[model samples]
Target: MPETTYSSDASGQGTNGSRFNRIAMALFGRQRDKLQDPFYLLLLLGFISQGFFWENTVVPIMLAALWFLLIHLSSRKYAINETTEILFLLLALLISIHFGRTAFMRSLSFGNGLLVLQAMRMLRPLTPREKCLSAGIAIVNIAVGSQMMLEYGFILVLAAALVLILQTFHKLEAESCGFHESKFSPRAKWKEFSFVVLAMIIFFLVFPRYRALSSVTTNLSIGRNAPIAPTLDPASGGMEGTGRLIFQISGDDIGYLKTFTLDTFDGTRWAAGKHASAFKRNLRVEPKPELKYRKAIVKEIALLGGSLPADGYPVALKGNFFQDDYVSWQGSIRVSRYWPADNNIYEYWTDLNKHLDADSRETASCLKHPELSDRAKKMIADTTAAAAGEYNKARALEKHLRDTFTYELGTYDLNRLNPLDDFLFNEKRGHCERFASALVLLFRQMGIPSRIAIGFVPVEKNEIGGFFNIRDTHAHAWVEAYLPDRGWLVFDATPVSDRVLQRPASGFALTMRDWVEFIWYQKIVGFTSNDQVMLYKFTAEGIDVAAEKVSRNSGIMILLTILLLALTGGIVIFRRYSAGKAGRSSSITYSEIFAEHFYRDLLRELASAGIRRVPSETPGEILRRASIKIPSAASEITFITDEFCKIRYGGRKPEEDLHDKVKSSLHAVKSAIKSRKTFATDLH
Candidate 1:
């Protein structure tokens, strides 16, 4: 007997040839002695964690040490190739270098080190275990890399690289076994993968996204301004040369447009200054006073992807307004240093001057106080108190403004040092901003506590939602006068003809895409989890939370969750079942079993004629039952027919192994019948 070098057990196939044994012996190489698993484990840990621990050099250095150990261990399995050599050098460079310009860049460098480790493992002669470890490292790298902002181009390249690695390792495995058969052909498999991706997209879109599952708030600093203090030179000349207008405001209330609050005036240009004594985190403006016969003008304001221009005080504002989440307030709205532009929506109704009456004088007076600005105090004192001649003087001043000053956009320029002073005296032709500024200043001159209110007018009617489409062109400004009992009344001086608030005909200002996006944000993406739950309940059983939660604990919520889970489970089970059934072979019918039994007996009766057939075959399968020689055998062949009748038509259970017995008898009958017929023919 040949000497068997390799032994095989019941568990798996064994190689016995001397040459095969030599190949298997190559697995335990000398390099394996120096390698350690901790290096790989550390890499995995760095990939999973975040923050200061990972951001600082501690985690990264630990990961590098781990990589060194794993490489040392891998030496025992496979010899290092040129690729692995380069990877070793790259690791040294990465660990020694520091790239701290950005968090994203730092993460990229760290991820690169992990990739190098994996690539080196793949280049060296790797066993199955080594291959698995490298693959796992690659997976961890991908998982960590997902947290970084990888560009679209890089994502495609990474996907291709992973596929190539998988295919290469699979080929290597097959080559080692001397077998090269692919489990699935590439052509059909890609189509299946595409369908899977499509199904995933559908699932994401339909799944109920629970918002409360994560308490971490999304810190979107897109529009937040940097906290760095800007440098200003007092002697650097006031205006930096006027250029083309950046924005334009036109409306019945577009008077005295204030684009910014500059309280930090350092003797030259007004800058961001300290907050007012009463400034609060979230200031709510008081609604204007309502009076009988007051003319009502609805103003629509838009923030054309820029900052809000207001005096550091807005006590109350109402409209469909969405402030950037990152917008902070050092007493007022502070645009993010990073992202400085955003669009905003504003709309509201204010009590017109027509609401004012003689009896409301005391109410208006009560609203005014002495600690107010000189301009406002003067304006109020001149307008109110009919006992003095100041009331007539205020009326005369108001009439002059209503009859004079032509309305136009861009009447003021960057060259104008005092925009308010220029509009009132030099430039008789001014826009809404100029008109409103003049009115407020005049009221202040009369000793009345009045402030300029900026807004817009003639709000656009959105064709899709029947809501208002307020835009930058609707930016407007007006005067708010405090009344004793009426609070504040909004008064506009700009003529209505100058206003431009409706959608423009050019189609450039308000495009269809913008409208669609607005609808998407307002309806779908903005729907909170609470909204989803309410909607689900409304669709399912017409229940609302307020009516039930106050009453008692309702098991309906629990039952609904369970029912949903069961429905999901049932779908999964049915899909798996259907998939299994699709792979099955030819099905059996009840009639086919009976036919097999009937044919088996006929073949058994022909046994003496040297004819034979299997019991599982049909009647049409037998053709050699013509050589039977005995007369008794011919009678026996007739008996086989009776047996077939009982089993096929009687519906009674056959005897144990009855089909085998019937097949034998049928073969004997065939030989007997054939022998008698063939002998008789020969004699003739």
Candidate 2:
């Protein structure tokens, strides 16, 4: 026996961190990957999916990952206590209360709270049965998170989760069958997933979307959540925000969607005015014409803060949402209550034609601080001096600002007593905010009713879906001046000079992303029972149309069909024939292998008795040699050799007597040798 010594290079990663990592991996890492790796990844993905609507997702995902790591790395001596269950109960209660109190926070408080609970359950060690239960919990977490918000993100997350979930079960099945270190093939994975995906697609097509459990495509765009209100403050925000799609507009009324008008200037920023109707101010509500002069625009939009923008006169705006939940305030639409999460495809007769009534003239004219700097007041008066009436005066002021002021997105001083004065007098370069603010103030001084309107101006229409993809960069501010003779007229004072124009947002990557989102929204999230019926109809109609077309060209179609069938039959026959040919050759069966094992053992036993057989020696030669070396055991050797030859080369099958015959022959040989030794010792 020798004591072996082993040494390797030290230093580098082989230090404490590496040592700990090695120890950790040896003790607690993937153990041949029996579903734990995929399960853990699935857990994290389930939490991450909620990030679309839930703000508290990152913390839960972090907590789950940290706790998972610690639990696996340690000995995991702990178990789930009654206290843990009680904590989960208390959390659920609090979440229910929060949901009741803040109804719109469905995805935020409740969805994230459930995920955190699932994460906390992983604090203890998990047995096989417990692991199965944990998998069920993960499913719940995924379902909870997914149902709260259905977006393109959730679709992606669910796709990944599906793969992981299927892998986890596959591993479990392998482990059950004693194949602990099962090697999963990527090809097999896709093959298995195809069946599941096909099943899911069929289910989605067949199942009617129940109103009680319908999901919503939430407004998760950062562009949608940006601070949209006007603030004349020196905010250090980016010049242009992210290019994420806020929403999309598909119709001809694809111009500016007025959200709200900034009525009063608190000097630093313009505050949104109270919700008031055109009728409240003694204004006539324009009826929707029987024939829309401008073609009807149907829009599918998702926005935050209950703001669903409708264009033009808001008298005849029709949508799939509750009429009671929405209100047309000052030509803008606002969802007064929680969204119904029901059918929608909102239609607007919006022509981008804005009009204000005589009743709003006085309200729009009033301002908080009309006293501008002396220079600004003088310049504005001189600019409008040639204007005859209110309409001319307002146009004159708008033209003056649009012509003279340079459009630049620059931060303005919030604390300045008069930002309008700064823009007009010192720095004439400003964005639409400044230009629109300057015009509004000048109109107020001239005894004209004007207010700043902040909304979006869509410029690029998607070439794929033919919809206007609105991003935060499309946000604009302009002025709406009231005229007693005509109506409220639109005016934008932001000059087009020196502004960076964006290239058409059309590329392979962008087109694909938009296309995926469009499908998710239109075909997936917004899918209804009606949609299901329509899908069936569409499928049936498509088949019928295709069949009709083929019938019209029956001669060519029959020839093509026959060729296709022959080709398919030939391919199938070829594959089967190839498989059969490959399988024809074979090896020894289990019984033959057993017989060979016995023959080899017989030779080894004789060699151990000091009658070693040469590798080249045949079984018969070896048996004879062994008998000659010990002549007393000649008959016993003869019987054993005959039996082995019969089975090994004579094509005899193993039988019940095979074991007994070999055992008895070997015993008889050993007895003969012992008897011979005794007799020879006596004679000596």
Candidate 3:
């Protein structure tokens, strides 16, 4: 092999090539095997953050810790074989099955199963493609968490997780390109991240949101479960307190939030009857003359099995977003297809006084009770026998039940043949369902049309925000009896004293927490098409107000002018301060001024000469390509291209004398092209 010596220019070119290669490697290098551990750790943190919204606590934490330890140990040169992978998969499957059964039973939920699979995936060694897929899985976990709970804390956690994931991927890219380990400046990373956050906020505000209906239909089941609808099945277990917050309402008074009404009693279960037709007919009907109507806003804080809650006899319901929501045949207002995930606000015009429609056709189904014992029928007859008017009889029956029966929680047994019989005669102690059911049966026995209204009673009033905080524990069932001439009136047979005593005292802390939750749902999660419209309306209103003030009040106008001037001065000072802190000048420099003029001249000359630059073509590339079309101006064009490249990329300072030279070159190029065109025209 012969040793070859290169000239100075060749040596300089080689140095520049090596430097470019080094920079490229720094940006796109492959990460070391050891770096995988840290990447996995970041992913583990993101996965565990999602668990904060899950129902199960211990399992998610344990799985995350196990996965983290496994990754750490594996990084120390421990080989994971096929047997270990199989065992891990089996363990994940078993855990998912167990958690799914414990949480939702035969219908598996994505909550536990998602976490289990993510952990299992992390357990195995990952390829570059697998790592990207893992990042995607982590994002899905975050998305699920967001769907589960739309809170400020959840948003914060999601943003943090996203930043961590992005940094991890950035590191992976750097490592893959063979770059040595280096620490990225937090300030610079945050500066870049700020733009991403701004873009997301803009998209959230401006993007047109189409309604997405839920695919999963909520199963209405029985037994000590959260109230999802107005219909109650006595065969289901007693209503137990889950202590989960369901929804919040803002109204003048704390009232019952009715979701459904059960009209037919067929021994074991109360269901919707022919009254559904009457209810549906009256869905668009106006309230009775005697009923007082009030406006109420219901904001769903959490998913209560996808059920929409509203006050009794809702005349009108408006969703936060533009979507079709209809009233169920049973008088419950339901979302068209699926239940909304979170932040679904409904504006309802509710009849404050619970009055049933007077025009509704009375059916035998409301009075039919196939399983009612003869003794129970006689007891109901005795209770309302002395009452002359239907109202008096209803009041007497309500008083009798409230005075005699004791109110207690967790008293109903699903196994009993007739739980109502046990509640009325044997046990004599039951929750609102028993009281309501007993009252309804008594009314039916007296030949009065009656039904059970199953829904939430807003008991806790958030004094701070003037909103009612309704929880699952507030679920109650009551009776509604149809009265002649007076329409249907609410008759509560349940003792109120026990429930009042059981109510927790609302403190300042609790009030503030409720206020925060209300704000979170209304301002952030609940923002919709209506909000965007309202925003524009508000801005327009503000402008009109400002104009009016300017026209009417000279003193106020002067103050406004002063304030505007002050604001402008403040902005100027702040920008100057920022530029100084960043070690940059706020004013344009000589090079920038020269570059701007040169660029504009080149564009104007090219446009006049019938030469246009494509969007994708650079200035230097355009100049060289256009030189062939205008040969007479080739030298001027080349000179401009070289000068522009020097000023733009060679870090050379612009000289005052070079500015005139550039202008002369541009003028010469333009004149030469014109002359060539005229000569060609004459020849033709």
The per-model lDDT (C-alpha) reads 0.42, 0.60, 0.63
In candidate 2, what residue range of length 10 has the lowest lDDT sum? 291-300
What is the RMSD of candidate 3?
14.0
- In model 1, where do residues sit more than 4 Å from their true spots? 1-97, 102-109, 121-259, 262-331, 335-406, 410-428, 452-684
CA RMSD (A), model 1: 19.9
lDDT of 2 by residue, 40-143 (tens): 66666665554433434575566555655655643544566757766885787576556543344443355555555655566655545555666766666676
User: Which candidate tops lDDT?
Assistant: 3
Clashing pairs in 2: 233-414, 356-488
Cα-based lDDT at residue 171, candidate 3:
61
| lDDT score for residue 199 of model 2 | 85
Query: What lDDT would candidate 1 get against the real structure?
Result: 0.42
TM-score against native, each model:
0.39, 0.51, 0.52
Candidate 1 lDDT over 129-149, as tens digits, reads 455566566555654543431
Clashes of each: 86, 2, 13
Q: Write the per-residue lDDT of candidate 3 for residues 1-684, one digit (tens) a residue.
A: 133532224233333456654443343232223334446656666566556444456745875766645554543444566466557656755665655422322133344455555565654566555676677667666655555445476666666776776687666544433223324557767877887788777877786343323334433322234455435666454656667776677756545666667787767777666554232532345444343333233433334433366766677655543244566555666543334444456665666665456444454556776557888887877987898887898899899889987877666474357776777777777677778888888777787888787777877777777777677678778887777777767788888743642467778887798788776766566666656765777889999998887889988879988999999999999998887765344223557567767977887788777788788655655775678888888888877776665555443566668878888998888899889889989999
| Deviating ranges (above 4 Å) for candidate 3 | 1-207, 213-239, 245-254, 266-279, 282-307, 316-330, 334-355, 368-389, 396-405, 412-428, 445-447, 460-470, 497-526, 534-684
What is the alpha-carbon lDDT for the whole of candidate 2?
Answer: 0.60
